[model samples]
Target: MRNQFVGKLVLVAAGIAVLLVLTPFAIVPAGHRGVLTTFGKPSPEVFDEGLHFRWPIAQSMHLVGVAIEKGEGEGDAASKDLQTVKTKVVINYHVRPDAVVAVYRDLGNQPGERIIVPAVHEAVKAVTARYTAEELISKRAIVRNDIVDALRERMARHGLVIDEFSIVSFNFSKTFDEAIEAKTTAEQLKMKAERDLQRIEVEAQQKIARAKAEAESLSLQRQQVTPELLRLRETENQAKAIEKWDGKLPATMAGGAVPFISLPAKQ
Candidate 1:
């Protein structure tokens, strides 16, 4: 009976060992990759999501989520125009599947916080330093592109791929904000003044054109009213008066049924 009990205990221990050994072969979840390392040396082979095998004694696996992950960082940077600006930037990134081993070796476990966030902050500062505060605020897309490009290039060394990057917010100093506002207001006023001047000039041109037309009409009338034209008008008036007169002759001795008035002799 004692021998049977000892044999049964040995079998139970063997079964436990086997179970422990098989635990490392479990399936990795979706969106995750298993990075296997042997004797602290990372293997070139990476296991994708699903059941994977690793050496029970000599190898250990690190599960890295290959899905896109988000990170945010903020810092103060100088603009191209020497204005200091504070900016908050957000980045979404992921480890390159083929570079998983390299990433593990270089960045170790916490790639998002250690590698990506710092790289983004550096890129943001570097790119921001090349643009003015006003440009940073208005042309944020350009700044974001620059940052993404710079970060992608920088993080590529660590086997990280930048999925997307954006500037969350940008803030300028109080003095700078006031200055920009004042400048904008001044520009608007200047444009308004220019438009007003143009309007006045157009109105003046119209008035001058109308006065010239009136002057031209008067000159034409003066040119048409000649001495011959005045004589013709007087003849027309006399003809109309004679045509309207009644034909009855006066009884008083006038000049043979026609009244004739002799003008006084001129002195």
Candidate 2:
């Protein structure tokens, strides 16, 4: 019985020794930081990714990720034009490595839900309210910048760093979409009408130019029509008829006299 009691005591001692040896060491995964706590009180000492040492059963290590994390959220707000705007944004964020203890203490394990989501919603709403629906679509870059800036400011206070912000989409009411389509069609028709009017004006001007050119040509010809020129033209016609006369007159004449044919003088 004495030997059995000694053996049982030895086993209990071995189990406690094993527990002490195993609980002192911790392995922090990559992209994570170890947050130490004692008696439920968090410590500011941060541990990098690797094996770390702590007091057995007296201190504990909690891991908080410092790696980039993606978050997406959707929200609805009214634009400056009083139009309903549904916006979706994607955000990349991470807790600052050095601020993990404070983060763990203040924000607990779910800082994403506690801080990031609400910040995104508020930022989107605040920025969207400053722009009209058309401007939100047309000036998307500006809108995104505004939202990111707002988020950075809001999250920075809580040690959450903003890496990137993106706008996925913006949806509007069906009536507004239809109105935009109708406006586009009307503008297209107006543009086409203006183009046709310009074409018609160009054609009319070309016709006027052609008419003026023809009138100028006729005026030049009339100016050159002298009596001498007329006589010269008539003499040329008579000479051409004589060349084909065959040196014979018509068989029958309107008068009983022979045809008076003029011959060119010897030169």
Estimate, for each residue in 196-247, the C-alpha lDDT of model 1 and write its tens digit: 9999999999999999999999999999999999999999999998898898
Task: Find the candidate with the highest lDDT and give its number.
Answer: 2
Clashing pairs in 2: none
- Looking at model 2, residue 214 earns an lDDT score of 100
lDDT of 2 by residue, 10-68 (tens): 99999988886558788899999999888788887889999988887788889999999
Clashes of each: 1, 0
TM-score of each: 0.74, 0.76
Top candidate when judged by TM-score against the true structure = 2
TM-score of the candidate numbered 2?
0.76
